[model samples]
Target: MRPIYRNLAGLIAFLGVWEAAVRLGLINDQYVPPASVVLTRTVELLGQEDFLRDVIASMLAWAIAMLAAIGIAVPAGLLLGSLPGLRTATTAIVEFLRPIPSVALIPLAILVIGGGPESKIALAIYASVWPILYNTIYAFTEIDPLLIDTARSCGAKRGRVLASVALPHAAPFVFTGIRMSAAVALILVVSTEFIAGASTGIGRFILDATSGGGRMDLVLAGTIVAGLLGYLVNDGLERLGGRLFRWHAATTTEAV
Candidate 1:
């Protein structure tokens, strides 16, 4: 209760400062509206049917893309990680593709997938898969060799060794990758919606606000909603990871 109150106080203070700055003309209200105006616009947007639909559409795209990324990247990463030669052979290709910005691929995606949900989801998948793959590979490679040797000496089959030894050790890294991918998924989702044009999502809301007669307040409001959604998703992922990877918490405490 104390922590919650403290956080609320801090947020209030920040908003008060923002409002003061804008009202005093210390900041350009035309470009950066007051916190009060933004908040008002946010409330108005909440009641808007089209805006609500856009939020739902963006969330649906993010969820589908994330699931697809996890399903594809995890198994591929595990296989490559278990096989040193395969990991080595694919290293260059993976490195090359991983750094390619998802935004850059929007044009190609639009052309191929069309300017719709498909393009957004495809872009999200492209942006997200690398984190899971890289983390899975890192997790597998970093496992203590002694455990592998012990499992082998116990007459454990390859599958048994992987199940008992590798998976447990790598689970934390896998989740970490997933958490990272969530952020990527959100970024790509919004970028695709924005660049694709006339897309029915928060990005479209932002576009409409910006272009529809200098509605800076609406733009700020839309941006605030996007930021809140991102923060909520990230917090949810963190909580989920903590629950699924209790061993990670134990290990951290032990190390400290």
Candidate 2:
């Protein structure tokens, strides 16, 4: 039993059980459509012209928001994390806002940003920044003090030490933060779209299918697509991080 084959077999068994339960009336199709129906509607959606447009819009919003979060968070986090006094001064404020749910800001965002694409992007960025910033701070604080002392003894300037020592050591933690940001960004993207009453994107598609009368199959199909997209994004980020930080991966593998 190969690992991949075992995974496939497990998936097939789960789907078969789900389909049987739906067919046997133990589960209601109106609320939770069978996997077969969802797959059929998913295929139909792939053929729709509007589907690509929705996907592109969602992807565009996600990319822009993520880029903005990284751009702002990394530099700002580095600056604050390097300055102990500044970090101490700002800890109270950061802690206060970090606990506030991003979804709770949607109403204020709608009022100010007017339920547009900009609002969605803004919310995504807001939700993503905390993870990136916090991880970066942790990365900086967790550096080996002995390593810094050794660098200083070897006559490395502050800039050289930071560029060669600090950044390299922190890279893994920073990438970990970005991975978390990606997941958070996806949630905010769909959530803002659904709540803002937008006319396009996967969230809107789900809303329309669910609310526009008997289209449980379509709703389930949209959900499946969303889940697949999230999975692919997370996997892609993990692969990229693994490649960029091969040393980290090697150390973890050796430890395991």
Candidate 3:
């Protein structure tokens, strides 16, 4: 079977089991609504303006974070990757800062930037930058030294060599990093919204839905929506990567 068909079939089978389990009282309906119930709620949420707005807020925050991260990481990666001296000089600082959890910084973010869009965006950018930066650096490192040397020997300037020989090879890897960061960016956005109790986003929607209690259905529904959002975002990026960089598509797909 095609992978999509297998995935669909598996999902259906899982939902069938869940529905049967709930109907048979193997699981408490009060705590865990059946799959049908949650799926209906997810569909309903798509039509509701409030939930849609929250989704949009989350997506907007993610988009801003991703754009900012890409803008910062790509150039920084190119610079650091090209300059062994600079890369070596900053290795200690980069290693020190890279391992700190962005979630761990939520408290600091809340205190410094407050529980606003800025705070969430800032946190998302911090979390999402690493993958792209590392990927870009790795991409530059992977370029064939012969290609660069050939360009230089043929009278190409440093800038010309980078722009021509290095960049094309790096483009695919940079895009792969972008795809990785895209998921991280979304996770950070939602996580910040939920933990910080931001005024908007899907995380807030889920929090609000469960605050009064006895709304497990709504909570699950919101969660389902969030999962779908993540899947769609990743899938879209994957397809785009495949189309834009056909030479690298197989590697990218396998990596993902």
Candidate 4:
């Protein structure tokens, strides 16, 4: 079967198991709630203006941060990757900074940029930048040496060689990096919203629901919506990437 059909089948089986477990008292219904109840609440939330606004807010922040990360990281990566000296010089600092958890910087972000979208955007950018930057630099490093030499032998200028050889070679890796960054960006956006307690976003909604009362159903519903959003975004990016880079997919399949 196609991957989509397989995914749907797995999801249905999981939900059936979840509902059965809830009904059979294998798990605490008060805390977990049935999958059907959560799905119903999710639909109800879709109809609410406030819930939609929250989703828009989170997605908006995520998009802005991801764009900013790409804009800043891609060019920087190309430049640094082209210059071995610069890349080597920065390796220690990059290694030091990259492993630091984005959440660890939330308090600093709150103090520096204040709360709400600004802080979340800053955090997401920090969190998402590494994947793209590293992937971009790696792409350049992995470029076939013979391709560059062939381009140069054809009397191609430095810029022409980069445009024709380096960039095309790196595009697939860049897209893969972007897909990875998009997922991380969403996670950071929602996590910042939860920790920073922004006025809107699904994470904020979940946080409020839990704090206001033990509204586990509503919380689970919001969690489900967040999960579905992530799945859709990743799936859409994957399809787009496949369309844009058919060669990459074929090569990957052969390698596998």
Candidate 5:
């Protein structure tokens, strides 16, 4: 079967097991509602205007953050990857900053940027930049020396070689990083909304559900929506990448 069919089959099997377990009293339905109940709530949420607004808010922040990360990381990666000395010079700082969790920065972001969409956007940008930056740098550094030499031998300037040879070679790898970054940005946006008590987003919706008399079905429903959102984003990006990078030679993990 196709991957989508296989995925649906697996999900159905799991949900069947879950529903059976709950019905048989193997698991408590009070805390963890049956799959049917959660799915019903999920369907209801899809029709709710308030929930859709939250989704839109989250997507808006995620998009902004992803765009900002690409803008900042791509050029920085190009410059650093092109210049060995610059990469070496900044290596220590990059190492130090890269390991810090984005969630840990949430409080500081709220204090500095205020507890609003800006705070979520800023944090998501920070969280998402590393993958794209590293991928871009890797792309440039991995360019074939022979290709660079050929370009130079043909009297091509550094700019000409970068634009013509290096960029096309690196586009696939850079796009892979973007795929990775997009997922990370979405997580950060939702988490920021949940933790910072933002007025909108799926995380906030989940949080509200939990706070409003322990609505377990609603909580699980929101969680299911988040998972679905992530699946769609990654799958869409993968299909787009496949179409755009058909000429990319390597059939490997990095391509996806």
Candidate 6:
């Protein structure tokens, strides 16, 4: 069977088991609604303006954070990766900051940026920057030194060499990094919204649905929507990546 069919089959089987477990009284239906109920609610939520708004708000924040991370990380990565001295100089600070959890900084973010979009964006940016920056640095390492030397020998300036040589060679790794950061950005967006209790977002919607409402179905439905959104984003980026870098795709297939 095709991979898509296998994935569908797995999903069906898992939902069936979940439904069975709830119906059989093996699990508390009040706490964990049946798959059918959650699926139905998820479908119903499609028509709800409030739910859609929350989704859009979350996506907007996610997009903003991801773009900001890319903007900052790419340039910084290029600079640091191109210059071994700068990379070495910043290694200690990068190591220190990279390991700090974004979630742990929520209180500080809230204090600094306040309890809304600004704080959420701050957290998401923090969470998403590292992967892209590191990947870009790694991409620079994989570049052929001979190619760079050849470009310089041809009287190409540093800026010209970077724009014409380094970036093209690094494009694949850079895209890979962006793709990875996309997922992380989404996760952080939702998490920040949920934790920071932002006025608008899917995370806030989920939080509201679960708090003292006994709305297990709505909660599960929101969760399903979030998961589906993440899947779609990742799949879309993957397809875009494959299309944008045919050489990378060919190289990967050959390796496989």
Best by lDDT: 4
lDDT of 5 by residue, 133-213 (tens): 888888887888998999999999989998989888888888999999888888889888988999889989989999999
Please provide the root mean square deviation of candidate 3 (C-alpha atoms, Å).
Answer: 1.9
TM-score list, all predictions: 0.93, 0.94, 0.93, 0.96, 0.95, 0.94
Question: Please, what is the whole-model Cα lDDT of each candidate in the order they appear?
Answer: 0.91, 0.89, 0.90, 0.91, 0.90, 0.90
Steric collisions counted per model: 0, 0, 0, 0, 0, 0
Candidate 6 structure quality by residue, lDDT tens digits, 1-256:
6998999999999999999999999999999989999999999998999999999999999899999999999999999989999999999999999988877888888888998798888788888899999989998988888999999999999999999999998888888888888888888888888888899999999899978576989988998899999999989988898888988777665421
Better of 1 and 5 by TM-score: 5
Candidate achieving the largest TM-score: 4
lDDT of 3 by residue, 1-256 (tens): 5998999999999999999999999999999999999999888889999999999999999999999999999999999999999999999998998899888998999999998899999999998899999999998888888998899999999999999988988998899899998888888898899889999999898888888785999999988888888899889988888898887765554653
In model 6, which regions exceed 4 Å deviation?
149-157, 252-256
Q: What digit string (tens of lDDT, one per residue) describes model 2 on residues 49-93?
A: 898788778878999999999999999889888989999999999
Query: What are the candidates' C-alpha RMSDs?
Result: 2.1, 2.0, 1.9, 1.5, 1.6, 1.9
Compared with the true structure, what per-residue lDDT tens digits does model 1 show for residues 1-256?
9998999999999999999999999999999999998999999999999999999999999999999999999999999999999999998999899899889999999999899799999999989999999999998978988999999999998999999999998888988899899989998998889888846999988988878997999988988888899989988989888888887887775421
Q: Alpha carbon lDDT of residue 243, candidate 2? A: 89
Tens-digit lDDT string for candidate 4 (58-132): 999999999999999899899988889999999999999999988899999999999868999999999989999
Backbone clash pairs for candidate 1 read: none
Clashes of 1: 0
> Which regions of candidate 5 are displaced past 4 Å?
249-256
Superior by lDDT: candidate 1 or candidate 2: 1
